[model samples]
Target: MKWLHQILFLLLLASAAASCKKFLNVEPADRTGSNSFWKTRQDVEAAVINCYGFLFQKFNDFNSPVIPAVGDMRCGGIGGSIASGQLGQGFYTLSQNDLSNTTNLGVPERYHLNDIDDWGPYFESIANCNITLAEIEKMTTLTDTEKKQYITEVKFVRAFTYFYICRLYGDVPFYTQPYDKTPRPRTSFITIFNTLIAELDAVKDDLPWTATNPSDLGVRACRGSVYTLIAQMNMWLAGFDKANQSKYWKDAAEKCVAVKNSGAFELLPIEETKRIFKGKTKESIFEFELNRNYGNTSLYVNLGQWMTHSPIVDYGGNSDLYFVRPLMERIYPPNLPDKRRDTWFYLPYSNNQTFMFLKQINVADPTGYWSFEDNLMVFRYADVLLLGAEALANLGSNNTEAISMLNTVRTRAGTPLFTAGAEDLKDAVFWERQKELIGEGHRWYDFVRTGRVTDPNQIITPMTQDQFDRGAWTWPIDAKARQNNPEIVLNLYWIR
Candidate 1:
């Protein structure tokens, strides 16, 4: 069956290639046997779906090594340790922290960084979209309206790709067109951001509120996701680029309100919300859908179970790591109710039993292995609300309204209301986000966005020069990528 599928895919590629000259005088690596593959409305729809598949492929579990290597989540198991302090030394080594280079500690342990060269996968996905869009533009089979909608969807995905790279690497070699010429010069952070914002805003009105067809299942880009990205990008711009701080903050606040008023989404109830990480909720705005039967391949691994396990259970069953630090657990206010506390951590007593699993793995089978249905949420309605509240507080003159918006999140979590001053209210919002979004990979970005890593009270621990040296904020460019393209500059913030 796999071989049959491969043959069919090759035939489709061949068909696509045969028609490439009709659309653009360029040849794709794989040829489609004939032009019939993308000559109909359904054909164009399938092409858009192929673009989405590329998006998922670029970031799926096969690429899981990059998450811990780049993101701020903790790493290590019961007896296994991350020599430089956090789990995975890719970021740490780039940051130039002092760790034993003698053993597989610092640079030597980072074998994957050497292997996965460049942002090729991400760019390849973008190129796929560009090629598809170019084909669709010349496709007369699809109506004008159909072409407009499909083009909007493709542009949204492309913008998201650039946004993802920009957030991670800062100034990257930005490209929207197919790489036919020598690589274009790297765009500055400011120009890249402006371009992203323009692209998103231009297509914002063209996207549908929701996908109307099953074929559009994970294919079409919706207003909610684009607005969410806009809010995030605006927030980042406000923080990192001070000259444009006010403008982007205002833009973020408006985008947040747009999502708030869209009426297409709502927060799941507390119980259902807890099941969200497991991928059971309707509130997910955008999630990477994983299916075990989609070849029984492990889509992505959950670090939560591995991160919080105690030594007793670490060596056995599905558990390998345990929570070594109290940073996440301590972020919640001491008096916030049990629901909030229990949601974030396995209570000490709960983990006291030798045979018990210390943390919750969203989907565990009867025998206790991690289930494959667990969906990793990239954006959810709850996150949108929190972001809205933060944006409002940052740019608007409504402290009371901000508090009310925040209390909505707290009330849903069954926690007490926050009555702190404006500054404290900001802290309240920050802490709430940390607690609510823990383990979902937002904490480190929050710290960096606010420039609060060094704040004594803001972070769970003081930001050590060692931590900074370890590239906690900036991800290391893959070593081989730099070697392949000498123009690729390592992020100086992370480099020693």
Candidate 2:
């Protein structure tokens, strides 16, 4: 079955002639080539949906080891033990001098560098966007207004995919064109930021504030979603350039304000925010929707029992695959009247059993077995508010406004509001982000952006280059990709 899936995927990729084929006709019998796929509006739309299919494919399983490999979280199930220690040593053990190739041995985890096969999913999606854009440029079936909207949607998705890659690997090849004969070099951080900003600005006026129809599922990019991406990119850029930090922060702040002003989203009430782990709230701006009926079972087995279950589940017995780090647990506000902790984590009892399992992912099979649902949220309104606060505070314009934004999130979390002035407000916001976004794979990036790894209170311990060399801050490029494309550069930060 796995081989058949691979063969089908290859067939899908090999026939570039049918790249723009309509989703409604995406059956094996209708397996036309990519060249014939983008001639119609329906074809163009299907291409875009195919691009998004990568999100489902890559993140299909929790134990699939994509985000957890790079983030603060560690895995410790029967198969998790090998991967668990690597994340700890990579992120927590500071300094580049102490790590060696031998350090990562015995780890069963697939490093991003080692998993070149995964790269195609991202690039393949980008290819779909490129093909759609080309077809749209020559399209006469749609009105000018419709063309603008379609073009903007494709551009937003293209920018989004590239930006996602940038966050993981500081520099990646920027492929705007569908076909490039010459080898494209890795873009600089500044160039990537400028390009992303240009794309977002160009498309902002074209996208709708929200999708009103069911046919538009994943069709139109929302105003809040683009703003969130823009805000996040700006905040990231600010970290690399301190002298002009305010510009980036202000950019983030403005986009965040746009999201807030739209009133399309709001922080889930304290009780509801606690229910986030259970996947029951409307606070999510965008999440990868998964259903068992869709024939995608990767989420059920990969992230379901492995990440959320303790010894209680048959498949996850005696494994702490999804256990929270001791350092993270310590940072939770003590005596805070919040239910997020109770809802998000499974506090262990005297017999080492969990007191409560996360309810959002709770799924029951017909045979009386249970597992978690695979839907993982990539962006949420709660994150947007915090990003806005951080951007405002970093800009040095409105510390008061930043505090207000931060306070709104805190109040929703049932925690006390922040009272500190500008300097202390930064720490307060930082800690707040740490607490609010834990276990969602944001910590390492947070450390990198804020230079917090050196701060004792932030990381469990400072990491070394020796650790970095073992696929730490930057994920290693797949060795096969380097073999296939010699132009791709390995991360220099890890090179001793």
Candidate 3:
């Protein structure tokens, strides 16, 4: 009954009018008349829920696994090859950074991920947040405290949406007002991030440190989530904005330290891998929910679809992909004692189909195709800890604190503690991130922001300096974007 109610609400949201003319081609409100809506608490709550629902649809687009294709495959996690069918072919195209030719890539069903180029989904989510923020003020039914909290939560969603799309497209039109039809050009991503950082800082404390209600735990925005977002944005700026790298690194480290000291999160034991990935545990800072029984299941959204097989998947086939053996060993050497190597992989160094990534293997029906039960983890505490370590290492003087943060995650993974000097600390943190956050979809972006995508020592598919400068890292903007707005410029790298 609860699931049915949720579905009904989502259907209502889907009924909002869509346009092909404007920058964001959708109405912000649900099907209900905006003039009469937001008069009651339930209406406000429903709109808030719709904001999250829009995000879920954006990430869980059934046509293609957008997140992994955008985030992980480009990192060469599939060893730049795969034995599986067309799916592997698709991932191979992504691995080689051959994104502009996705349409021509033979396996049209699996390889043509034009949706990744479309900014509509992200804008739809942003529009919802914008309207909610605009009209929530008119709600006399809710108290000031409640209004403040909801505003901050919606702001978090909007900020996160801008951050995500900016990373993908490099620069995007910034919008805040509801039902904004004005055509606008892409703003600098650095300026947008800086604006968002301050806006988040202003409203962060309004949200609770964590959700007290069990249902809201990781799905709702919290202070910890806000802090982590700020830290991540700062770390990203640290790499690209070299003039102020030290300030960005320091800010990132401080924000991460705040999250750690908040005592609201802790890393789960290495043995509780299932619990950790199942999501909404103490480890999760923020995640989008997906329950098998609740009629929410995403095959393309989970790594289990491509990484698990046989007894684990009840499919009489081998894994669709495996990490490159050299990269795997580079992160987890045979001589090293890493519980992640043992617990997360069947054969850490296997180049064949027997190599299975067990981190996301939680399936409800081994024999059925739609059984992936793990929620889409957007941020977890361990990822924040590692980002903190990376930021501190970049600061040059915080080597000792950086090692302390790195060791916290390592100690949980039963890996050897990092006892290295400042010179080696940054790569150590980077490798730890590769090992800790693999398949959860942070790999490719990490390489780009860290400026390690061109470092042959770090990346398997290093882009050249000229390629990097020419926007090889960004996804191509869909031609549809320029339909209504001549100001909309597509990523020229993909124009050929």
Candidate 4:
């Protein structure tokens, strides 16, 4: 039960120490109770798992569905209400980029929409990662190799957490040392991304190309995940730093190419939707696990709760949400022969009442409990392939390689290969990602990183350059964020 004790300790530490004073208000490292727990390999493993657990708790907070709310729904594509017309007001405001509305109108307290504004959970998780990284180096039980791997694993978790928060909040206070509590101002996300790129590049080779254990596949950090994260960070950096855009694009393309050539991952047939979405598979690069049999399942965190109706989930009559018709048609024109359209949806072009998305329909108890049975796919092979295609296209050469990567995903999805038809290669790659990765909490970030957030044709809620320059794309940091840290600041646009 030592692992259980370690898990409990981490959970209690995260909860008890949650604050905004230099990201967390923890006891001095010298006096912390966890100092005694990091003495064995099991303890290290437990801490690593706790790192991921903290993230899971953050994403699965109450009924928030934080990922999709911030990543997908905000793009202004959803058209229907969950039930009462009042319940949709907060979501509607969110979709319109109105981040100041904490009341959420008719949204009940149980739903916890405002949790999206809070960055404390992420910092708490990052704190755990920092603690584990500092403590692991002193342990004598692990060999240098074992210690290196464990250190790299914790680093990945920390870097991944930072990358995620950077995407959401833009600039954030960056810290790597253990239990450093000095109040620090937000660091340029560019600087953080650059540091992460170098840090990950140095340690990525230490991880195996793939997890040898089936259970750990996609659920644990691997070389594929590390490369994918680096590739993504490069693309994001490229978006904000225009002067070195070409260099970042090339780096992204190269990292993605490494993932492709590794032979450790491949796109599962689009028809194998359940196997792919159910978690550990050849297609998944990284995902968070949720198995109902283990009494670990979430109703609101997964998209199924909002996108499915009666047969899929006994939710009375209609689904709680539906993709806008224009957006649906734009991505999947009726004339298109993409299997994703047929395989992932019912009534693809239909009205809101009956248009149900089936991409994540693994219901644990469809007729009764109605809990979702799909892992939160943070990264997958197809996503990497598409990102590679986008990066290659941005570099303006290697057009053939770009098209090949783009078409590989298309071929698997039973869609026509790209031939540089009327659609530009870059646009084709972008639309392919929108089509293939729809409903998986990616669309909004895709818009922001690609400069499509200001393009009316690309997104429903487009932002003007002036607004975007003022941080219109970021969520409002909760007032609690500045409670103890005087150096902390909120997003300017949200305040205006």
Local error of candidate 1 at 137, Å?
1.7
lDDT (10s digit) by residue, model 3, range 1-496: 1122233334435433332111111234446454555567766776676677777777766636777778888877475233446455656777788877756544447433767788876886776677678778777899999999989989999999998998899999888877676788989999999999999989989988899987777889999999999999998888789999999999999999899999999899988988887888899999987776555666767665667788887776667677878878787889988898899898768876778888887786788664687778999999999998888888878888889999999899887788874338878888899889988889999999988999888898899989999999998888888876788899999889
- In the range 1-496, model 4's lDDT, one tens digit per residue, is 1122244345544443322211111222331465556677766775666677677778876746777788888898777764665236777777787776655534567778777788977887777787778778888999998998888888998999999999999899887876667677999999999999999999999999989999789988998999999999999999999999999999999999999999999888888998899989999999988777655567777665678888778877777778878888999988979899998988878767678888888888787757886888899899999999999999988999999999899899887888976679999999999998888888899999988999997889999988889898887788778876879988877774
Q: Which stretches of candidate 2 lie over 4 Å from their true place?
A: 1-29, 34-36, 61-63, 74-105, 108-118, 214-220, 273-282, 299-307, 310-319, 322-325, 348-360, 364-371, 421-423, 464-472, 493-496
**lDDT accuracy of residue 466 in candidate 2:** 58
Of 2 and 4, the candidate ahead on lDDT is 4
TM-scores of the models, in the order given:
0.79, 0.81, 0.92, 0.92
The total of clashing pairs for model 3 equals 0
What are the runs in model 1 whose C-alpha is more than 4 Å off?
1-31, 61-65, 74-117, 213-220, 296-300, 308-318, 348-371, 420-423, 460-472, 482-484, 492-496
Tens-place lDDT per residue, model 1, 388-416, is 78877876677766787788788888887
What stretches of model 3 exceed 4 Å from their correct place? 1-31, 77-84, 108-112
Highest lDDT model number: 4
| Tens digit per residue, CA lDDT, model 2, 403-466 | 8888888887777778874347777788787667765656667777776765555565455545
| Model 4 regions lying over 4 Å from their true place | 1-36, 82-87
